[model samples]
Target: MDYKDYYKVMGVERSATQDEIKRAYRKLARKYHPDVNKEAGSEAKFKELGEAYEVLKDPEKRAAYDQLGSNWRAGQDFQPPPDWGAGFEQRGGMPGNEADFSDFFEALFARSAGGARRAGAGQGGPGAQGMHLRGQDHHAQILIDLEDAYRGATRTLNLRMPEVDAQGHVVTRERTLRVQIPKGVRAGQHIRLAGQGAPGLGEGGAGDLYLEIGFNPHGLYRVEGRDVFIDLPLAPWEAALGAEVNVPTPDGKVALKIPPATGSGRRLRLKGRGIPGATPGDLYVVAQVALPPADTEAARSAYRRLQEDFSSFNPRAALYQGAQS
Candidate 1:
């Protein structure tokens, strides 16, 4: 998909404040409005302006858009980076019709709207005058440590909340929250905090805040579902002859026994050692055989002795047979 530079579309600078952006959008919008200018492509130009304004006018969307960086140019081939909108808190619904916006706008903000709808947010639209209506539920993504999923943790998260200031210009206010993360919370799971979202009208109660969980990049392990996987490096001798080695896990280090004749890429399962729960997931230690370098005379001599001992063993025999077949 092509990148649409909203600032360029609205004829504003990247450094333009909310007020400046508003004025620029208004001026361009008036010039491009279909009724005012009957010229060809005027309607398309007007729609483009509206799409740009839709994003630039909202502080939350604008802040998220800016995070995409200033390097992207208009009409350049672009794809959003993974987890681009991970930390920002967004309101429930979008104002305009989805069909009116371009693919670029939809790609960025449409999923948030869909998530809010799926969460049952903004139900029963603002009722009659003076009627008490529930506040809209908010959504955001947060990063946590892999260990935090194994053992519950308390995390402090700073969220950016967008609101119009006294001057009618959008500004972001930082909100810090202390949240409790439950154990066995997998990636993409949400933690709901009641009454933490937008305030209600009149006497209605506040809505909830849904925090989607994600794990920070781990150096030693990779997780899928509740199961965890880790590479266990072993020497050739240790693979050939059974040996016990120390293995690291989320809980702590434990001794793992290697079976004799264990081959590389063989998985050794540790029952119920993964993310803790009623029926816990298993941890798999994948074996990786490490060959010692023959840089020294002693190491070279050892390799020569092993080669002589296993003179009949041809590791490439299968390859030669397959070629002949």
Candidate 2:
């Protein structure tokens, strides 16, 4: 797909504000309107202008589009990355008719306009006789800990949704839901709660709400997919002579056996310690040997003794020879 530069289409900077985008769209729309311009290709240009404004005028759509990154150039061949819309809360309202939008716009915001025609199909909108429409599905992203993936959890979220008021105009309403986080749900996965989205129009059931999974940055752990990693600090003696230590896992602390002559950056794995599933991921501990400060006389004496003990050894001999080569 060719990447559309909405900002360039509207002759505005990528950092332009909502008001700036609106003004640009209005000016371009008037200049390119088919009724006024009558120039060849004026209709297509007008449609393109509307599409750019459709995304840039709204904060949510604009933010979601911007997350595609700024590296792309206008008309560049592009495909959206996986999890493109993973961390956004999108409601089921279209600013204008969806039929006027391009294929790229539809693909990007498909979830929002999933049931647009049926949302208010029969009762009285444009070109309506009487038809039933399924309610539109809504999507949101929720952040959880690595432990929550190991052990199932329930999370509460507050959302503002659109509702049709007595005057038949849409109004925003705050709604809260306690959602379940399934065990072994990895990052970028989704939890679907049935019948939790916008209510159906006539004789149709409510839409489902999809919660996309995201992980909060952990102070002690780093997660990549289902696997987990943590830096394990070890005393110099513990690394050299080997020791049994209690290591923290997603579940709890477990006894880990350190092999003798272990070096810094050595990785040790605990099988089946990561996210639980049919096939579980392992937990890896990266070794980081820490030395005691040689400030006191006793510590300095011990260090001197160690230096004397290993006087025949040259740690940088290999590096020095390599550099000479």
Q: Write the per-residue lDDT of candidate 2 for residues 44-153, one digit (tens) a residue.
A: 99999988988877666776788798888988887766457544556546655536777677778755333333343223466433545656677676678788899999
Candidate 2 clashes between residue pairs 3 or more apart in a chain or in different chains: none
Model 1 lDDT, residue 17, Cα: 77
Against the reference, the lDDT scores of all candidates come to: 0.85, 0.78
**RMSD (Cα, Å) of candidate 1?**
5.1
Model 2 misplaced stretches (Cα beyond 4 Å): 1-20, 26-55, 62-88, 91-124, 160-173, 321-325
By summed lDDT, the worst window of 10 consecutive residues in model 1 runs over 114-123
| Clash count, one per candidate | 0, 0
Best by lDDT: 1
Which has the greatest TM-score?
1
Q: Which stretches of candidate 1 lie over 4 Å from their true place?
A: 1-12, 17-58, 71-84, 93-129, 164-170, 311-325
Could you tell me every candidate's TM-score relative to the true structure? 0.74, 0.67
